[model samples]
Target: MLEVGSTLPEVSFGYIKDGKMTDPRTNEIFGDKRVVVFAVPGAFTPTCSQAHLPGYVALADKIKAKGVDTIVCLSVNDAYVMDAWGKASNAEEIMMLADGNGFFTKSIGMDMNTSDFGGTRSVRYSMLVEDGEVVKIFVEDPGRFEVSDAETMLKNL
Candidate 1:
């Protein structure tokens, strides 16, 4: 797993904007910026939909007030699903990013195999990045959601 002081990998995360696909590289998003990034195993899953992403959406303004340039919610789903979920959740202030194939998740060593409940997926985690380097990271254990929530990230900031 990526640790504090580790730079984010060079990879592209897909999303939808204005009805078109946008794939931004990791550096483009994290470089020269303070960003809050959180990842879920899949989009629209129970905990993710009900608590994980919604917490960020509710606290986005406060998080950005602490000099965070962006708040990203990432998942191992397609752009279409992520976009839809963002809209459904009223997450206009958050960036909904799609891993699509778990490439970025695997590259960061946060990938897990579930066998039945969606195959390869990313474990739940949240991080604070500054100028492309991780300054703080909170990774949740299997089936747990304690340390990686928005309130925790906000308090840490």
Candidate 2:
């Protein structure tokens, strides 16, 4: 996994914004900004829908108050699904990014293989990125949601 002091990989991911598909590169979003990025295995899955994304959605304002320029929810899903999930969660303040092919997740060494579940998915993780470099990272253990919660990240900030 990408650790502290590692620069985020140069990758572009698409998302729906204002009814249009918007693809933004990592630099465009993380450069010159304090960004909090959290990745999930898939969208609308049990833990992610019930807790993970909701936690961030609920604490987004508080997280941003701590000098965070953006709070992003990333998943290895397509733009349409991501957009729908964000809307369903009432996550207007959070940026929902779709890593359609898991490229970004693989690039950061956070991708995991789930043969019976999903083909390839991202491991649950969160990071504090500033100016395109990771300042802090929290990666959850397999099948766990202990460390990468929004509350923990907020407390760290």
lDDT of each: 0.95, 0.95
TM-score of each: 0.98, 0.98
Instruction: State the lDDT at 100 in candidate 2.
Output: 95
The digit string of per-residue lDDT tens for model 2 on 1-157 reads 6999999999999989899999999999999999999999999999999999999998998999999999999999999999999999999999999999999999989999987988989999999999999999999999999999999999999
Model 1 segments beyond 4 Å from truth? none
lDDT of 1: 0.95
Backbone atom clashes (below 3 Å) for every candidate: 0, 0
Worst 10 residues of 2 by lDDT: 111-120
Error of 1 at 156 (Å): 0.6
